[model samples]
Target: MKYQKVLIVLLTICFTGWVSLSCHTNESGGGELNDGLIGYWKLDGDGIDYSGNNLHAELIRSRKRPDSGSTNDTEHNDAWHQVSASSNLKMDDDFSISVWIDALSPDRDVSGDIISQYDVGRRKGFHLSLTTNPSPTGVGNSRRLSFGMDNNIASEWMDCGRPGQALLAFGLAEYNGDLYASTCEPEAGGAGHVYRYDSENNTWKDCGAPDRSNTVFALTEYKGALYAATGKYRVAGSSLPESENTQIGGRIFRYEGAENWVECGQLPGVEAIMGLVVYQGELYASSLYSPGLFKYEADNTWTRCSTPDGKRIQSFGVYDGHLFATSYDLGHVYRFDGTEWVDCDQVGQNNTQTYGFSVYQGELYVSSWPSGKVYAYEDIKQWRDVGRLGEELEVMGLIVYNGQLLGGTLPMAEAYRYQGDTTWQRMDQLDTTENVKYRRAWTMTEHAGRVYCSTLPSGHIYAYKAGETVAWRKSFPEGWHHVVVSKSANKLSLYVGGELVDQKSIPTSDSYHLSSGSPFNIGFGQHDVFQGRIKELRMYNRVLTKHQIDVLGSPD
Candidate 1:
């Protein structure tokens, strides 16, 4: 009986040791390397955390699809998995988040979050997403992967100097890592000129006028080259005296180099090229005064697409594999699926026109005229009025900057950042021109780590370096891609499929403590809900070495 008891004790000890070993081993039959792993979720059939950390996530408003490899399955924007905030999940200075995702093509012109734990109210924490629009410096492209973080501090606004004797910096675009602005210079011998911003010298280098028109209204990048659109902007629209320059400008031009432009022909029966956008590998342009929508075919060639109800369209955006346009007529929003235009109905009963569109936190928001109100898109023909921007009469430029939705208003020339439901906090009065009948904080773009806005009347470019974001600036490509984001010391690094794609340094003084109190999200955060399938999400409390990340990202 004594010998039998001793044998039982030995067996029990061996059994306990085997159980401990099994807990450390991953489901893929790997061990030892996942030492700092605090959470590992194999979202195969559920949100169970297999890291033995009990950090299981909860699915909220999520629906399972057959994984058809396209966005045609169903709307996944409302779905996400949430893990409760815990001590282990609160990252310090060094940490990493790695995941495998099969991102679906966006159904709207908006960025979608992959993984995040952010507090939009406080503007703190970190997020990884895919951008559907260009950044201010024009360094990154649409559909590029981006990672950003907010340190809970207000950024100082800097005046980036005026672009010539221009009344307005009409449009902004980025090309070849350089920032360019198109101006409406009504001064004598000051026809619309495109100026390149020299960041090192903090001055605008005149790239000469693309046309004799009074305004170079719009700018876009297409097929590795910069394109500019011209307009004979009616100053009367701003309650200002009409300019003597009567040069017609319904033409488009391609930038050749320093002080040179190549004519790309003119739009038939159109007076101004109001907006330009690239949708599904093709360039599309809108007419300012006419109900015309044309697609670029070749140099000096364009094909006219059917306009929505024969109504004029203005600002262009892309979402959900379709093109979206704000109307200069009827104030309605329209969606074009590369074939027919679907009327999205008017924004508000009192508003006369819609100016710009931005996607924030999985919903589309638009700025309106007359009412100066911003509306969030809910469903077909449905919009919820978020709020009005102070006492302004018109709201123009709308963009998602540093995890917040911001709008530029006319008359006051003020910029307001969204602060949740029906609440907006004024950031600043960008255009401080005294006694002007109408002043406008007109257009905006993101570049480097700053948000830049142009002002009418002042014609000055103002920039605020807010949160830091590093982007890949290229399409993320189809199929499952392994993505890893890591923060070590004062630098953020992004790795895709085991290769370092981009890296940027963060200020050491900035707060890197990522304990935002927000729940750790798997498919949702600051941007829209992810429209894709995610699996094998792992979070570590320490920076992962390149070799470790490579081994994990390698195809099985």
Candidate 2:
């Protein structure tokens, strides 16, 4: 369908169902589609509006579409159809624009513009386009839906945790009487596999693949069925282009009785969905594609809803009786206050990447990247810094268990129990061994009276029995580490060479005024004895910056 001067279908009028929109450019106010849709371009060969209105699309084909002369013949990166500034294209207080097109090349670096008159810097006009998407597994040619208005500043077409960085487990949920999670181990080509926790056996059993996809990112239960959102279409055992590790699309699947699963639908404009939630008796899903909120109506039936103030809607959770979601790029939170989505403000810090959302103690909390800190939601105006989980960058998965919230961290690939928003306790040594050593704890859930978790790299699930949490804190192996521990009436600081690594409050009155003994029997006197070899231990009368600590702790 190249350039035939064809009669293009411009969706103008509105309808009862958003999926079933009314768009006949024949005349304004003639059909339900009413936001003054002025111009229409057929791209058959011209930018003439078919609405009987004289407004025509301008010549701004940054990349022109070559005339194939027949639909069978295809054209690649021909050009873009566009219209200059027009009041008709401008958006109002509330509006929606829809389009129908066959995106040419998903491999194109610059996203293919579907429709828009947006001025990004001015942040005024609206834009809809087919943006390139690389699956979590590997980069492959793929295009997903993306849309945003100039007013919506954070409107980027794609988000995978962080820009250009691989994502951890994208989805997690509870089903039946057991907990289930999907693994996104792109490095091992173990994508799109599901695992079910068997508490009785204290292990995970592979649930197998839902379809031929890289990974499953979102899982939910609705109306007596287990639904899994899966995508990232890279061929197994093949290396994507070193330059572009683009992930493909994903689909929605339903557990068809016992172990069987069937396809129910796919995320609109996007191949995969980040998070899903049951709100007001309706199932809503968030996507980096169309980059907005969508409500599921039926199989293959979803309606687009509100747009967020950020680029990508990474995940969603219901908090304080309201549906709250996090936008990844801007690290901001938005809430559904029954009527529409309202900006609940953003997390303040260098970590602009917000990953998961969960509510604990009736308060809302979100996990972030790079900084690896969690923040508590008080209102749209303020967020309390809940502290860091460790030195991990991506605090990928977060869930509530045992009357407390648990978060999963990256690089270390471990889980931590949140304590009073001030301290965090290690969950356990679930990931023990080499090979799969550096994975992240992707998801944590409770099943059969136990906490079960899943991790990346290995893409395996493990169960945690009711017992004392382990404090297997290890020290820098033979190297110089600047470990700094600050002291209070009840606590003392622990520093390696110079860095403020960790701090714990141990009772007993004794300050380390000397560089001699095992520092009060490794402190806590009765807990245990030091098992590893120790070298230079220094007591500093002052705190040191990371750089100074590094220099002091350096082995060289």
Candidate 3:
């Protein structure tokens, strides 16, 4: 009851041997749960993995022990990660990643050795970590970057101290002379310093505003830009401040150039902005304490994208031509197809994990939290349990490149790549992992016989050419949300939204340039199966001019 600001209840009713998704549809007025369950025949269908009583019993047991502090409760927390076995989780020119999480610990004391200790003396709940690779210590240590609640106030903890360090929030990024400071623990300096590793020089440098008191709760890179939201005030290297004023406010900011972290936008009505993403050429922000999603247009404006039925969004990802967001309340996955949002949790038989999501090889892949199992779904309303991976590894970001599905893990900066069926390869062997710790490949792009993966928190980019062991890396001027590589007769063209951002040309033989596939396999490479949606797909065997590319953006 401490933080139950919103309650989302989903009920199941059985009437006349029929399983209804609603207990009292008229009373709730939330709409029908399942319209296809009206009539029931004998249990017979294709691609339906019915575990009979076993799955049913597991679900029942989970519901009965909802208050248990076991990992099972957290395993199913809808904060899981995803990986692909084939192609990358491709998004339409626009997409967003949304996630909801129930914070487990508000205090930094986790009953373990103090590898890192820089607490801002606030309530730091749900710490999210980020680090640089090759590690500053040169032994591949996890330079974790975690975001948590400090003193009932949302703050961030940088693991620059150790594998699991907790640094307190000193201040916010402001343009004026005075830096934003916490009301409590005024002795600590505002504008906390974050270390961004310069891979070329192999050294850590202080980035972000120095000597400010703005607390950035959530950070994301959208459309070649870095965005952060301010929430909950607390002093660095301390505990929860006793003032209610520092514990109850929120704001949003975006980094301009390299040092000036200015306020770009704000979540007006929402209580706390948890996540931000760029979908369908527009920016989307998710609020953990609210049921709706907001979008930012090209003209720099925000609007509510859609309102869910009181479900808290845990995480969001864009695949194929639709937008997918996970719900923490009842393991529901919602898909936005540029229109109304459709509840497709039934895709996983109501037992699906709502945390991790990815789109790979034309299929929507979901990795369940706590449970640590992965499932692939042709449809989000119906999921197919594939198999299990590592135990207790909370899978987060999933990407596919060069015929392999890659996944990012927490606590451990090591990432795994799925090789074919039942084969998992360590991604750290590649040279790219040498410079990134806790690198979540949120954005993956392929162009000119090479795959590009960008890591979060560090904002570094790495490109792996075909048959190459080491990745050619670079730093972005701004964090990029999504990357698109368009090919016109063997020539590579890149575009964001409808504008061309990056491009290159590759020489091709006659066999490579003249090949054509139906439906034009837009999301995942060239595949026959249509697992995801195709918004606007066009393939040309012959080279098209710049005018033609513009026409593709607007068909006549």
RMSD of 3: 23.3
lDDT of each: 0.79, 0.47, 0.35
Best by TM-score: 1
Q: How accurate is candidate 1 locally (lDDT)?
A: 0.79
**Against the hidden reference, what TM-scores do the models get?**
0.86, 0.49, 0.44
Sort all candidates by lDDT, best to worst.
Answer: 1, 2, 3
Each prediction's RMSD over C-alphas, in Å, is 7.6, 29.3, 23.3
Candidate 3 Cα lDDT to native: 0.35
lDDT of 3 by residue, 1-556 (tens): 6334333222222242244324344212223211111111111211111212111101112222122234331222211111111112222122111111122221111111000111111211111111111100010111111111111221121121110111222111111111111111122333323334332453334455422433344444444455555444333212223222333323456666555666655556665454554455566667656675777653335776665666766466554445667765666678776667888764344343455554443355665544444567555356666644444344444544333455554323335656544445555411223343332333233322233333333334344433211111222121211222334443444443345544444334312211111111111121112111112222222333444444333422
Error of model 1, residue 383, in angstroms: 1.6
- Write candidate 2's Cα lDDT for 1-556 as tens digits: 6433332322222223343433322222234222233333344555556645554544332111122122221121323333444334323322222222333221112223333342222323322322211112111111222222223222111111211112334544555444565655454444466666554554556676776556677676655466777666342312222212245545777776545778777765676666666655577676654475677788888887867643576576643345666776667777775567777676866777676765443345788877888887765657888888866666766654323457888767777767664678775544443653356676665443345555544445555533111110221122222232233334333343443333444334422221111111110011011112122222222333344444434544
lDDT of 2 at 342: 78
Number of clashing residue pairs, candidate 1 = 13
